[model samples]
Target: DAGITQSPRHKVTETGTPVTLRCHQTENHRYMYWYRQDPGHGLRLIHYSYGVKDTDKGEVSDGYSVSRSKTEDFLLTLESATSSQTSVYFCAISESSRSGNTGELFFGEGSRLTVL
Candidate 1:
């Protein structure tokens, strides 16, 4: 096992509501990322952290934020959610390889957030 799991496998909320999704990992790795996936589009990065207490925003970072004060946990928060954000959210971790990233990431099943 890659030692990763996302919480609230399923979530339902109304538009404009505040939502928080949790990502937990036990890989003891240095990189963690949060992404959203929707139809007709590839995985879009929302936010990511390079190490404990070290984080940065990503391409589609609007309406979202993240926190990582511990090595095994990362959290994503939607200040005011929207229907556009009602997509499947995934947490992934990259293992350092002498061979480079290899674009390989171990992902948690996913957290499906539905905003009505």
Candidate 2:
């Protein structure tokens, strides 16, 4: 398992507030990803970074932003959190294989957020 940690395992905040979630890894994997798990969405990608300062948006990235300043850290920020953003956010790390990305990911426990 990769050494992944997510801060503020649980949180509750009002709508329109800004929230940031931090993901830290000790494995130094080449790739990191943020995903939100909802009842019907399974795991939907919010953003991902392939290397330091290299990031791209994903399927559900409208209200989210991400930053990767170091190999071991990735940050996700919701500019103005909304009720629809209430979900379990997961951080996953993976290393690329010789041919390509292994597509295997080790996930953190998860951060649960609620917007009232």
Candidate 3:
């Protein structure tokens, strides 16, 4: 696919540290989101950015932040890593051609994180 790619597919971190994940897209999508996926909880949106330099907190924004200064890049940062944050993170892009709902998303392979 000619969509998006995430860096550092896997990571292991200690509690009380900092971590940042990168998401790069090729299609120059307008909507980008950073989400954490767990077994029981599915996907929890940490943050979402609509346009460049415009972002808002989502359902689970605590201890996490995001920035999108360019059209193709969005970064997610965990201020203080925690054991509870151990999960698979996914970056996704939403786009629509015919223009209805934008419909579905294309996701990166995902980044696995473990905190001990």
Candidate 4:
């Protein structure tokens, strides 16, 4: 719960429209991540940012994009909404995990998006 906040926690949009989700944190953590959760797929990473303006694509980043201009904020956007992208999106923050240590990720509640 590391002071993470997500906006527009619930949204419904039509296909082909643009959608954006905002994640704001006060923890000043170095790593921020975006993930989507769906039935049978658990949670899949969409994108992640390691530092200010430094980001990378993840396994499920086909239609998603992300940006981090500051340490406490991260944004995820879907260029064009699709039914397949309708899912619960989560924002997580974590520090580097070390060997033999249990790595923990603090996640925001969630942002649910529906594409109709």
Among the numbered candidates, top TM-score falls to 2
Give the whole-model CA lDDT for all candidates, comma-separated.
0.92, 0.96, 0.90, 0.92
- Where's the lowest-lDDT run of ten residues in candidate 4? 95-104
Candidate 2 runs further than 4 Å off:
none
Runs of candidate 4 with Cα error greater than 4 angstroms are: 96-103
Model 4: per-residue lDDT, tens digit, 1-116?
47999988999999999999999999887889999999999999999988899999999999999989889999999999999999999999887555532447899999999999
The residue-level lDDT of candidate 4 at 15 comes to: 100
Clashes of 1: 0
Tens digit per residue, CA lDDT, model 1, 1-116? 79999998999999999999999998888889999999988799999998899999989999999999899999999999999999999999986678766667899999999999
Model 4 pairs in collision: none
* Candidate 1 C-alpha error for residue 66, in Å: 0.1
Clashes of each: 0, 0, 0, 0
The all-Cα superposition gives candidate 2 an RMSD in Å to the true structure of 0.8
Q: Give the alpha carbon lDDT tens digit for every residue of 1-116 in model 3.
A: 85799987999999999999999999888889899999999899999888899999989999899999899999999889999999999999887466554647889999998999
Estimate the TM-score of every prediction.
Answer: 0.93, 0.97, 0.92, 0.92
List the candidate 1 regions with Cα displacement exceeding 4 Å.
97-103
**Model 2, span 17-61: residue lDDT tens:** 999999999998999999999997899999999999999999999
Candidate 1, after superposition: displacement of residue 92 in Å?
0.1
